[model samples]
Every structure is written in structure tokens, then in C-alpha cells.
Target: MAFVTTFSTSLRSGEGSSICGSRPLSRPSQRKMVRIFMAQEEQLKRAEDRMKKTVETVKSNFNTVRTGRANASMLDRVVVPYYEVDTPLNQLASISIPSSTTIQIDPYDKSVLGDIERSLMEADLGMNPNSDGSVIRLIVPPLTQERRKEFVKSVKAIAEHGRVAVRNIRRDAIDKYKKAEKDGDMSKDESKTNQDLAQKLTDKYVKTIDGLASEKEKDILKV
Candidate 1:
């Protein structure tokens, strides 16, 4: 198929002539360009989505780590034995943060309170559970200076993991962009531009993860 058809003769009245030493691109070429643009945009969008998910994971992890205050999400990993099968504590009971330092767990069945208490103790959350046969209470003790430092380190590690995830997404996007160039679907210049854009996006997300970790670190370090 002809990508460009030059006019060898001058225009006849209504016949359009190639303007500025250039002819209009053929329909097939225009469609191909559109497809390439769409594909590049899709890769960029996928990279952004991956970065968002990684950041969300980091945020969730920050909530799970111990703080000066009690959080319901801290018990996200707590599982109790219910009828021989391990079940999530939230599924078997209602968890409430009644105060800054207290987490209340009230079992729906009432009979499983003991099991829930046991799970809380064995979970190694560094907090003891008090059960008075009906409701279980977890009084989150104040974090020691040393423990707060430990928490800061832990949250920093999680933030690093998120940054790595964002970088991995960038790598995947660059790979797709390079393949598109190799397959003749896009030009080398297009591939390079996409790679640069992906890198910028990765840097932006990594900075966001760092900021999140820094905020959590401050919270942990605060007296």
C-alpha cells in the first residue's frame, strides 16, 4: 500500500495538490499510527495502576504495624479456630476501638471468646488479651522508645518494597515499549519517549511511598 502519493503534475481546478512538499498520509498509515498511540497509552495507564496498587499495599501495611494508638486493621491477620477451621477474627466477632489504647473484640457466638483470646495471645502481637468470659479486651500498651525505632525500621522496609514494585511496573512498561519499536509498530523515538515517561512515573510513585513511610515513621517516633 502507498504511504504517500506525490502529485507529479499541477492541481486541476478542484484536485488538491501536495502542499509544502508533503502529501497526506494514506488511510492505512493513519490507522496504524492511531493504534500505536493507543497501545502506548495503555502501557502508561497500566504502569500508573500498578504503582497505585503498590502504594495502597504500603498504606495497608502501615496500618497493621503497631502505633501509639489502637487500630482495628491491626487484627487483620488474627485468625481463630472455629469448628476445626481457622477463621478471620473479624468474621467471628465485632472489633471496636473504643478508645485510643483499647481494642474490644466481642464474639457473636459468645462461646468462641476463649478461642479468640487465645488467637490474640498466640499471634505474637506483643499485646496481652484480657477476657472476662464474655468480651475480650486488648489494651495496647505504649510503645517503648526502642520499639518505636524498631517500628520505623519495619515501615521503611515496607516502603522499600513498594518502591521496588513501582520500579518493576516501570520495567514492564519499558519492555512493552521496546517490543513495540522492534515490531515496527512504533518508532525508536517513540520508544525512548515512553521509556522516559515511565521512569518519571516510577520516580513520582517512589517519592510518594517514601513520604508515606516518613509520615508513619514520625507517628511511631512521636512521644
Candidate 2:
């Protein structure tokens, strides 16, 4: 009988198929579905990890606040207004740590060297640039009491922005979870479970962000 054959196949399929033979799937079909599900789960996981890494990058950028050190991160987002185009300082020059308190920038284009210096000053990272016609030298000055407070505030703002980005990713994941539910790919209970898992993912990212920020804050506070 067809029903008997269908039941036999369903039993051999190991329970990934739909209940009552409504959408009976063979073992190979179930494995394929599992692979698809795992791929999607891995994609979401990678996205969440990216969010966390972004938070760390932002924190690193803020750590460029430098209590008393010359770090390249401080200039990461500083745009050099070159040839009417905004360019990253690193692209214009080579950044190197000559000393704990000195960062050297050797520009490929001597003409744009001035532009890079100007950009650094404009960024208000509080460093004075010294140029030797070929390489620009930045002397990392000690942080003043008032300036340290301002730097702390700036780092906190960066962390808050990271938190916002992580939350946005969480929202996007929730949307995807809902879409999966609507497509009938996931049952209501499974949808709820995935939603909870997504929230856990968000929380984990947020926690990582917080921990990274805290460590960077300590670095910035070191006198």
C-alpha cells in the first residue's frame, strides 16, 4: 500500500519529516534541510560576531585617546582632505611607533604631508606634529586632568554607539526569525525558541562590548 510505503519511509527518515506524512521527507532530504538550517544559523552567528568585533574596533579607536602613548588607532578614522577627496591618514603615509610616546608618519607624497598634519590637528587628538620635510612626527603629550575627563567621555560615547549597532543587529535577526515563521519553515514553538536564542546572542555581544570597553577604559586611565 502507498500509505504503508510512505510510513516505512518516514520511519526510516529519523523524525525530521513533517508529522502525519503531511510533508514526509527522506533521510537525505532531512540532512539537506539540516545543512540549510545550519548554514543560516552560522550566518547569523557570523553576523553577531561581526557586531562584537565592530564594538572592539570602535573601542580600539577610542583607546587612541592615549593617556600617554602614540597609537595608530587614533588616526584610523581621521580623514585627510586630499585632492578634494577625504582620505585616511594611513593611506597618505606610513604610521610607525618610533617610541612609546612618538608616532612617525612618513608620507609618500610630500605635498600631501601637510594635509595629513592638518588633518591630525583638526581631529583634535591633542598631538603636535613635527615634520622633517619627508616624515611627520607626532609627539604624544601627557593628558591634562580636564582632557582625560573629556577622553573618557568620548570613549563612553563610542561604546554607546557600539551598543546601538549591536541592538540594530538584534532587530535584524528578529525580523529574519519572523520571516522564517511566516514561511512556515519554523513552527510557532520553534520560532519562540529562535527568538530567545537571538536575544541571547544579542546579550552575549553586548557583554563582550562592555568588557572590551572596560579594558580600554582602564588603558586610557593609566597614568
Candidate 3:
């Protein structure tokens, strides 16, 4: 009888300390906290990745938006007349902008000299090509009023494309947040907060695109 009572007293003392464990991390409450933190971190990483992709997309589309200044992208889509085959101007020749309104192209194949010049004139860049059998030069003329208006239209189209990209990013981020909530990794309230933050980021990027468009329009309008 004495042994049984002694064993019961020892069991009670062990249970009290083991259940309370001195370190908070060893407690069930703390385990839940750690799980919540991990879930939040995962969600944050996903959101950050989405934002990065959105930024890159914005940059790429912005380049295509066109500025009044000379830029490689301005000729990125220009095709050269290569010996009966169409080729990107960049591949067929070296294009250089010696001045604000001049672009020089030196073709690798001398035989296609005339063809390159013809293609440039056909590019509708509002410039004439000056060639001397080896190299071709393009003189970018000052934009006319009607030409500026047309360029503005092109700018608007590019801006709309950027807007679509930003909206797509927002949609993807929101979908991720919803998935996190469905997986029990996030509460509804937390998901809502993250979605709102993501939307704000989207707005910022959209504004950046708009600003680029405005600057480009002003430059194109400048005489």
C-alpha cells in the first residue's frame, strides 16, 4: 500500500512539469504559433515572386511603348531587305545612332546594300536612306504634327497592353491568396489583407506605365 501511494505522488509531479515544459516552444500553444508563422512566410514569398514578375513585365512592355528619343527598340521590329529574304535589321547589319536624328546601318553582305536601303525606306520610319554601296544611313526627320498624333495612338495601345499585364498579375496573386486560405494555411481576414496589399502594388506599376506613356508623348510632340 505504501509503494502504490509513493508511485502515484511521483507520477503527479512528473506530469505537471512535462505538460508545462519550461521552454515555450515545447508547449502546444507555441507549436501553433510556429505553424502560423511558417504559413505567413510562405504566403509572403509567393506574393514577392508575383511582384517581381509583374515588374519585369512592366519593364519589357514599357520599352515597346516608344519614346521620341532614338532607341534600339524602335528598330527591334524593323525588317531589312536581305537578298530576297526578310531579316531583322539588327541581324543583317550593325545599327548605330551617331546623332539624335541619325541611324547608320552597315550591312555584313555588301551585295545586299541596295536591298537594305530599299527595306529601310519601306520601313515607314519617315526617313530616307543614304547608301554608298557598302553602308546605309537613315536620317530621322523631325516628327510632323500628324506623325506625332499617330505615335500617340501607338503609345496608347502599348499602355493598354501594360495595364492588362498588371491586372493579370493582380489576378494571379489573388488566386494564390485564395488557394492559401483554402489550404488552411491562412485565415480569411489575413488573405483579404494580403490581397489588398497586392492590389496596391499593381496600382503602382500601372501608374509607372502611364508615366512612361506621358513622357514619350511629350517627346514625340516636341519639335
Each prediction's TM-score against the native? 0.85, 0.78, 0.69
Give the runs in model 2 whose Cα sits over 4 Å from its true position.
1-43
Model 3, C-alpha of 211: deviation from truth (Å): 1.6
Provide the global lDDT of candidate 3 against the true structure: 0.69
Winner on lDDT between 1 and 3 is: 1
Distance from true location, Cα of 82 in model 2, Å: 3.4
Give lDDT tens digits, candidate 1, residues 57-113: 999999889989999989988999999999999999999999999999989999898
Which 10-residue window in model 3 sums to the lowest lDDT? 11-20
Per-residue lDDT over 22-84 for candidate 3, one digit per residue giving the tens place of the 0 to 100 score? 642334554454456455555555665665676566555555544456655566667865656
Clash numbers, per candidate: 0, 0, 0
Clashing pairs in model 1? Answer: none
Backbone clashes counted, model 3: 0
* Residue 203 C-alpha lDDT in model 3: 82
Deviation (Å) of 55 in candidate 1: 0.4
The candidate maximizing TM-score is 1
